[model samples]
Target: MSDSRQFQVALSLLPYVGAKTAKTLVSYCGSAEEVFSAPSSRLLKAPNVGQRIIKSIKENKSQALEEANKQLSIAEREDVKILIYTDKGYPKRLLRHEDSPYILYYKGNADLNAQKTVGIVGTRKATEYGKAMTQKIVRDLTRYNPLIISGLAYGIDIFSHKASLECGLDTVGVMANGLDKIYPPAHKNTAFDMIDQGGLLTEGCFGTMPDPSRFPQRNRVIAGLSDVLIVVEAAKKGGALITANIANYYNCEVFAVPGNLEAMASEGCNKLIRNHQAHIYTSVEDIEYILKWDLDERTTKPIKKSVGQLTMEEQIIMNKLEEDGGTMAIDSLSIKTQIPLGQLASQLLMMEMKGIVKALPGKQFKVVH
Candidate 1:
């Protein structure tokens, strides 16, 4: 890669140099090359340069250089792009965060920065409602063509990526480890699709597998990149909640889809809504309403309705289907409306016969208009 890029990556490996300290160092010495060449005495005089840091720099300079070189070699081998905080291509939204990484290793489409970003997060052990809601809301949001950002963990995270891809939306999966491998290897296929579709992102260097400790560290990046963070479902404690907390810290709008009060999977969502940590979103309209994102223009052309009337139950089901952009499952509608399954089936059949709705493979019903 570029010498300038190498110097910047080298700076990341310097003893005690973090994002904030690196900024000061670059400002003090004028460039990464200058900082490397500057005398210890001169470096100590730089703003916020502590004597301990200076001593580490002086004593470990060779070791630090070796480490940096190793990392660069690995990155070159993998064809990964390393973006320093100072790079123009570094995501601007992330740069605004207080603890943004000094350097990040990324692979796949670099054009992910070209689109608006939205985060979809929630519990790993998702419920049916959570799964359906995540899928439905993301399907609606994809019409806007926003980039999807989420941790690569299972449950809601995978669902988010899957739904986004299905709708032809580019998606970025933030990993808690290096891009050299996928975490929860079950998501390998999804991860592969994401590399070409959007990308994989992480601040951790090459060969660093995602340890438990790194995930909480990883959540901030997800929060920083997106303009809005939506928690589809969560328990009282889960990575999604941590991501939501980080998003709130970044001043990004936090949204939680309202869930059943009695469901174990929804406890965290209920808490978020109750404590005002997140706005209540039962549908995409709630998200658009709070963010003032216009859905009218982004929404797909409404399917045409035939010149026919409908029975009372069929009419109610049709309206619900319309509200969801013509996608609703029988079980979900039955639960939502407190209608018996047998009755709901009769209504769906009547609606389907009238051409008011169409039945999908997944037992999902969609309104024609």
Candidate 2:
């Protein structure tokens, strides 16, 4: 229902209120409804509460709620999901950043919190080299089944999205404008396809235009969503570089494709590497190394272990691994075995000592024959 949702959306609509201020209000007032219901005297008691913000809230409260109601109606009509910052369905990775948007309009099937996520960003003026690399990277990363994140702009962004679709990988497009209107209007078909496979996400509300300023803001979302960001190509001053910089600030691993020297598109990437802001990306192995992903199963010969001798819990772990190609991460094993991480880890260690299973990189395990 749009009951609490209207107020949550309205919190973002209030004048002079941004992500931090909105979060502060919610923290102090318990909820958006309480923030509205609280008197000016109580509002004054909230941290950083100023006369201007209070007046804006008091005067425009009804109008913001009305606007929120309209937004909810439009979202309902379009099948768009409005994620409040506090919602469990909101992207957990994005929530870690202090400047992350308090509201997200998402329309897609992709899990924003997929086990692996790779952000691909580059110049709008992508060359054949850049375009080729974008697809190459997406295709190469298929083994990990990572969710691809991009800005949905021309050149590299669109290339990544299309590549992801072709590879059957989920890819989310972070747009600078509202979901109600796809900017550039050229990639409409691809955007529509993404809605089924991956999805589109934006912090902008309905009717929000894609201004020059909003692109940098959008870049931050792409960076925040990604576990690791790959810059296929970038110019000296572009959204791609901005995204890479933001990723570095957020402590997210970043990789830059090595491009030819004396090329404008390569300048940003080369500079990023030279400045130690990003790692040099050559192959999918580079990603696997940084992320500690155990994509390839161990090829070593399995040790003989009798299945009948295994404890009930060890048998459960064995069954799950065998069900999932004889390999799984510790987190995944715990999930499938209905065991807590601490207990699962202890059991896996004992199994390893008993030669019933072998450990692999990235905290993964494989059952021995």
Candidate 3:
């Protein structure tokens, strides 16, 4: 890496030098190298700089360099890529936010500067309603090529990533920890796959473990990277709420899928709607209406079947199969797509009888082209 890159890494490690502070320092000093080369007196003149921060900057310079080089070694071993704020490829939406990070570590194929980005977030312990909403919104959003952004936690986050992958949409999973490790080890496999299909992004440097305090801070990044934030479900309190709040602060459109009021998972979403903090979405059409984004002609085509032609369950299964490839294995597709196997079998039989799908050998099924 060049001197500029090294300076960015150094600045990020400073105790009180957060994204906003770094931006101010860099803006005043002309560049990260210039900031580093500036005297302590001159550095303290920058906004939000405290005496303690100034002392740490002067005293921690050597230690910061050693740690930065170590972080680079770790990043190299993991094949993770780092981007500084000045780098052309750093996410444009995030940079436009009030306090975007100066350095980001990412691993994936997604373009950070994707055309339209939407965030899907919710509680960890999700309801069936939340799962269904997540699947529906993600499948619809994929038709427009919007980059899906979310934390890689359980419930809505994982559901969004899985659905986006199923629909072949690019996604970005933001983390609260260093890129060197995944916080929730259960998501290790999903994180690995995202590197090839989507991406894992973070503002934290190497060797930093996920601390509880970092999550709320991490939520800002999720909100900043997105043009719109959709809360699939949430309890009365959770990280999703934090992201939604940040989205509001950023003046981005915040949306929530309504759920049964009796369910615990719907509490936060209901509150958001009741308090007028978020717009409610019944379908992707509602989101499109609010954001004024044109829907793809392919996705907007009405299902051509008559009401009497297919049962409600069959219609849903057919829609999923169509959004995906029309051909899918009866079992794996049932699991991944969240359709009940018995219902799916019945639906397939009805479709087959109606000439909508043809049954293949070994229990496989393919829709009639």
Candidate 2: residue pairs that collide: none
Instruction: State in Å the error of residue 48, model 3.
Output: 2.6
Superposition error at 87 for model 3 (Å): 1.2
lDDT of 1: 0.80
Residue ranges of candidate 1 with Cα displaced over 4 Å: 295-369
lDDT tens digits, residues 32-138, model 1? 87877789889989988988777766676677667778888888898788888777788877765668887888887836465568889999998888889988988
| Candidate whose TM-score is highest | 2
Candidate 2 local distance difference test against the native? 0.88
TM-scores for all predictions: 0.76, 0.80, 0.78
* Backbone clash tally (model 3): 0
> Mind giving the per-residue lDDT tens digits that candidate 3 earns over 64-94?
8778888777788888888888889888777
Q: Candidate 2, residues 99-157: lDDT per residue as tens digits? A: 99889999988998787788999999999999999888998999889999998999899
Question: What is the clash count for each candidate, in the order shown?
Answer: 1, 0, 0
Model 3: lDDT of residue 113: 86
lDDT of 1 at 35: 78
- TM-score for model 2? 0.80
